[model samples]
Target: MRAVRYHEGGDPDVLDLEDIERPDPGRGDVLVEIEAASVNPVDAKFRAAGLPRLPKTTGSDLAGTVVAVGEGVDDYAEGDRVFATGLHTGRFAGGSFAEYAAVPTDLLAHLPEGVSFEHGAAVALVGVTAWRALVHHAGLEPGGTALVHGGNGGVGHVAVGLADALGATPVATARPQYHDALGDLGAGTVLDYGRDDLADAARDATGGADAVLDHMPDTYLGTDVAAAGFGGDIVAIAGDTATFPDVAAARSAELDVHMMSMSNLATHSDAPDIGPILDRIGNLLAEGRLDVTIDRTYGLDEAAEAHRAVLEESFLGKLVVEP
Candidate 1:
């Protein structure tokens, strides 16, 4: 099997494509012959900084078919098609950027009947992250307003679409060109993050969004905090501990700031209701209620190039690498 792996972490050059032994499935695992994989920002970060393993293969999203099943695995059989997030449980296992991988059945999900392999690979990680952020963490309601920062990116685009699907009024921030683009995706209004004063723009758009989903915590913590309405929820998927924008503003307004990781430790615990979230997202895709956006695609051998493209921040949506 041909796979991309790195013995040590550093830059994009560290990822090397090599021929390696194909892995066999363990008990309760499924060996998938990968058809496509998507490169995420976290994949690059982990590959460059190193995750839990050395000589690691880094990729989180995949769409593939089962080629072998391990002992006691009944939910899937040989030749079953599927798409899944390899990081749902988070110990790296030669992730999706390869010809084959042995993934625990608990981390796999059945792909919808009509969804394409590229779309499946593109949607899993970002889709689930958006769904959990808005529906579960932010607790968005039909009559409420939500703001999605970086709305042109993978997770942001999905958050905009999903919020609209759930009947919430979505307001997203992006480049000026993306205003009409996101408007088509169900954003009632779009604010250009580069030009507009986000605080003022958000206030005008949805009378100050009740919930704000942010991807750039290093910069937007203050912007989101100021843009939020009283008692609003500001959910962040990135960043470490940082000072509050204005302690007085947060305290006086009673705002809540949620730190979300969407990591294995966060999702895979005694709380077994992951099925409900995945099922809802699956049904949405199955019924065409959820949108799967593939901004670009690359050949399997161009995996390193795909990583570079994503790192350069030139993508409008998910970037997929097809085998």
Candidate 2:
């Protein structure tokens, strides 16, 4: 099998597609013949900064068919359509930018009947992240309002739709070009993040958002604090650490602030079970209630280019690799 690997991290150029021995499924694992994989910001970040181990395979989320299952695994069978994220898992683990990957059974889920391999792969990580942020951590309720920043990005778009599907009104921030699309995805209000009145407008739209899903908390934390209603929850999914700009206001409102990383949950023993979450997302996809937009697709040979585009280019939704 051919896989993209980086012996040492530096840049997208470090990724090399080379012939490698196919891995066999170990105990509690499933060997997937990867049909499609998606590129994520984490893929590029890990590619450039390096992981704990060297000579690592690139890519993370994958959708394919189970060719074989390891010992102690009976939940899945050969030829079952499946999709998974966090391919860097327990024994026999490898990244998804390959012809095949041996992923742990815990990370695997049945790809719904109508979902394509490309869409299945594209939604894995981003869908899980959005679901965790809005539904799990924030506890956004029906008839509540959700303020989502970066509403055109992968997770943002999904969050908007998920919030709407949950019966909450979604107020989103994105560039002008994406307002119509965001509205179509169920964002009740779409604002430009650059507007000086962003905080005020978001508050007015929903009478103060019940939850704020922030992607760039370093830049938007204060705004999020300002936009949220009393006792509102703020979930920050990305961005660098910065001092909270309005500690007094946050305190006054009795806000609940949280920071989360899906990768951490996938790897940590104390984390909640994600299998059921993925199952719910699969159901939503199958029902056409959740959708993932594929901005582009790349072949295995263009894995390096995929990495470059994911970080350096401006594109909506997810980029997929058809292996």
Candidate 3:
């Protein structure tokens, strides 16, 4: 099988295409013939930050067909179209950059009837992240307001779609060029992060949001704290640390501040399981209630180029590779 592997971490150039033996399915695992895989920040992070093990196949989300299933797996069988997470080594090990991947059953979900392979693969990682943030953590309410920062980002895009699908009013922050696209995706109002009064614009739109989804907490925590309504909740899905403008802002608003990492769900044993939410998203995609835009596609051998594109430029949506 041809897979993109990095022997050592440095730059995007470290990714190389090499023929490796296919992985075998273990107990409760399924061997999938990967049709598509998506490049996420974590895939690039594995390379830039360095890993303890060399020859790491970096990718955690994939859409493919089941070739075979290992013992104790009866819910899925040969020829089942599926998408899964945890590809390489983590809570799940989802190395979907290869032509074939052995995915744990818990992390797998059926690809709904109308969803394409590229979208199915692209949606798993970002969709699950948004799902955990909005549904599990934030409890975004119907007809209530949702303030979404970085609405054009991978997870932010999905968050916009999910917020709309849940019947909530969504106000998003993005560049001027992204306003139309995000509006079409259900963001009630779009504010330019660079030019607009983020806090005031968000406050006026639906009179402040019940929940704020801040993807860039390091820079936007103050904005989130300011935009949130009384008793509102704020969840930061990205960044390791945050600095607030003052304790008074959060204290006066009575905000429920939280830091969320999608990786945490996979790493911790007691974190809420995302398997069922994955299925819920799949159904929404099938019903035409959810959609993701693919910005680009590359093959296994062209992964280096894809990595450079993802890390260097600002693209509108997810990027995928077919192996």
Per-model TM values vs. the true structure: 0.94, 0.97, 0.96
Instruction: Determine the backbone clash count of candidate 1.
Output: 0
Candidate order (TM-score): 2, 3, 1
Model 2 agreement with the true structure over 39-156: per-residue lDDT tens digits: 9888888888887467889877899999999999999999999999866543323799999988888787999889999999999989989999998899999999999998989889
Better of 1 and 2 by TM-score: 2
- CA error at residue 119 for candidate 2, angstroms: 0.7
Off by over 4 Å in 1: 265-276
- Report the C-alpha displacement of residue 6, candidate 3, in angstroms: 1.0
> Which portions of model 3 miss their true places by more than 4 Å?
none
Q: Of 1 and 2, which scores higher on lDDT?
A: 2
Query: Which residue pairs in candidate 2 have backbone atoms (N, alpha carbon, C) closer than 3 angstroms, thus clashing?
Result: none
- Highest-lDDT candidate: 2
- Expressed as tens digits, the lDDT of each residue in 97-195 for candidate 3 is 899988888787999877999999999989998888887778887888888888888888889999999999889888889999999999999998986
- C-alpha positional error of residue 223 in candidate 2 after TM-score superposition, expressed in Å: 0.6
lDDT for model 2 = 0.88
Global CA lDDT of candidate 3, please? 0.84
Q: How far is candidate 3 from the true structure (C-alpha RMSD, Å)?
A: 1.4
Decide which is better by lDDT, 2 or 3: 2
- lDDT (C-alpha) at residue 248 in model 1: 88
